[model samples]
Target: MSRLDTQIETQRLLLRVQRAEDFEYFAELQQDEEACRFIGGTAPRAAAWRKFLQMPGAWAVQGFGMFAVIEKSSGQWVGNIGPWHPEGWPGTEVGWALRRAAWGKGYAFEAAVASIDWAFDTLGWTEVIHSIDLDNVGSQELAKRLGSRNRGRGQLPAPFEDVVIDIWAQSREEWRARKR
Candidate 1:
C-alpha cells in the first residue's frame, strides 16, 4: 500500500489516507458556508467532487498530502488536515479545514501538531507554512498555537492567485525548540 494509505492516530482522532467513502463528509464540509468562506466559498457537489480528489492526487504526485481527519470516538470524517504544497504554492503548508460541527474542539490543533511533526521528522522538511486568508482568525490562532507566526504576504496557484493570504511559518529548528 502507498504511504498515504497509512494511518496516523492521535488521542481523539485518526488521520488516514483520503478514501471514496469520505466524499460525502467532504462534500458536506465544502457546502458549509462558514467553513468554506476562507478556503474558497461553498461549492456544489460536483465541484466538491473534483476538489475532494485533489488530496489523493497530491499524495501520488508529491508523496505527501492532506489526511482524512476522522473522529476516533465517532468514526466520522471530520475533515482534511496536513502538509500540502501544490504547484506554485508559497511553501509546504500544513493546512486544515474542518466541518462546522468540528470547530472549537481543538481537533485542528491536535492533528496539526502531529502532522507538523511528521513533516519535519519523517519527511525531513526544513520548515512548514500556513497560507491563511487574512480574515481567517481561527486558522491564525491555530497557526500561533503551532508556534508559527505571520511572515508576510503569499501567493497561490492560478485561479487562487488573486486571493490574498498571510504566510505563517516556522523553521524546523524553531519547532524542535518548542517541543523541548
Candidate 2:
C-alpha cells in the first residue's frame, strides 16, 4: 500500500503508517522508562530521534512497519503497533509499545488484532510472532488473549541480539479461526 493509504481504523483507535510528524510522540515514548523498559529501555532525545526514524523507515524499506496508534476518544498519539521484522530478526513480529499513559486500557490488544488481520489479509503473512521479554507479564497476557502460544526463545537484530525473548506466535490459519 502507498504510505498515504496505510490506515486502519477500529472501534476506538486509528492505526496509520508512521510519518515524520509523529516523531515527537514517538520520541516521548522511547524516553519513558516504563514504556521503553521491555523494548530497549529509556534513551536520550538524540537516540530517540534515530529510533523514531525507524518506524517510517521500516514502511519505506520493508513495506510494513509499526502503525502510529491514535486513540479516537482523545485523538492522541498513544503509541505504535503492528508488523516489525528488522534484519537478522527472529520472526515477522506483530509487536506493540504504548506510552505509559495508554497502558491498561486494552488499546494494545485492540490495535494488535487489527494489525494481525491486516498482516494476514493484506500483507499475506503466513504467521505472526511477538518477541516478548520474559518479564513482561502484561504483553504475555495480551498474547494469550490473542491465542498466541509461547513457542520458545528468539533473538533480535544487532545492538539487541543478546537480549533474548520468548517467541509467542500463531499461524495465520489459527488467527483467522480464532477471530471467527
Candidate 3:
C-alpha cells in the first residue's frame, strides 16, 4: 500500500485515511447547512454518500487524498483536511472543511500544518495551495496564520466554475523557514 495510507497524530487530532465507519459522521457533516455553506451546499443522503466516496476513490487512484480529521479526545470524525488534486483541479491543494462544532477550536490550523508537512515532505510537493471561497473569512484567516498569502482569484472546474475563489499559497521553502 502507499505510504499515504498511513496516519498522522497531533496533540488533539488524528489525521488518517477514511474508514467505512466514518461515513456516518461524513454524512452528518455534509448535511450541516452552516458547515457545508462554504465548501458546498447541504446534500441529501444519497448525494452525500456519493460525495463521501470521493476521498477514498482519490486515495485508490491518486495515492493521496484528504485525511479524515479525528478529534483525539472524543474519537469523533471532525472533518477532512489534507492534500487534494483531482482531474482539472486548479492546483495541488491542501484543503479543509470542518464540522460547525469543530470551529473556533484551532483544530483546523493544527491539522492543516500536519497535512501540509506530509504533502511536501512525503509527497515531494514543492508548494501547497488552499482554494478558499471569496467570503470564507475564517479560512482566509487560517491561511494567513499558516503563512499562506492570497495569490489571486481562481476558477474551479465545471459545476463550480462560477464560484468565486482565491488561491492562497506558500512554497515548501517558505513553510520550512516559517517552522524554524
Q: Candidate 3 lDDT, tens digit per residue, 17-91?
A: 888889899999999998998887999999989999999888888889999999999999999999999888889
Ranking by lDDT: 3, 1, 2
Per-model lDDT: 0.92, 0.90, 0.93
lDDT, candidate 1, 100-160, per-residue tens: 8999899999999999999998799999999999988899999999999999999888989
Compute each candidate's TM-score over C-alphas: 0.97, 0.95, 0.97
Cα error of candidate 1 at position 8, Å:
0.7
The residue pairs in collision within model 2 are none
Using TM-score as the measure, what is the rank order of every candidate, best first? 1, 3, 2
RMSD, one per candidate, in order: 0.9, 1.2, 1.0
For model 1, the stretches where C-alpha displacement exceeds 4 angstroms are none
Q: How accurate is candidate 1 locally (lDDT)?
A: 0.92
lDDT of 1 at 164: 95
In candidate 2, what are the lDDT values of residues 10-124, reduced to their tens digit? 9999999777777788888888888888998998989888888888889888788999999998888999999998888788889999998998899999999999999898889
Error (Å) of candidate 3 at residue 131 is 0.7
The number of clashing residue pairs in each candidate reads 0, 0, 0
* Model 2 quality (TM-score): 0.95
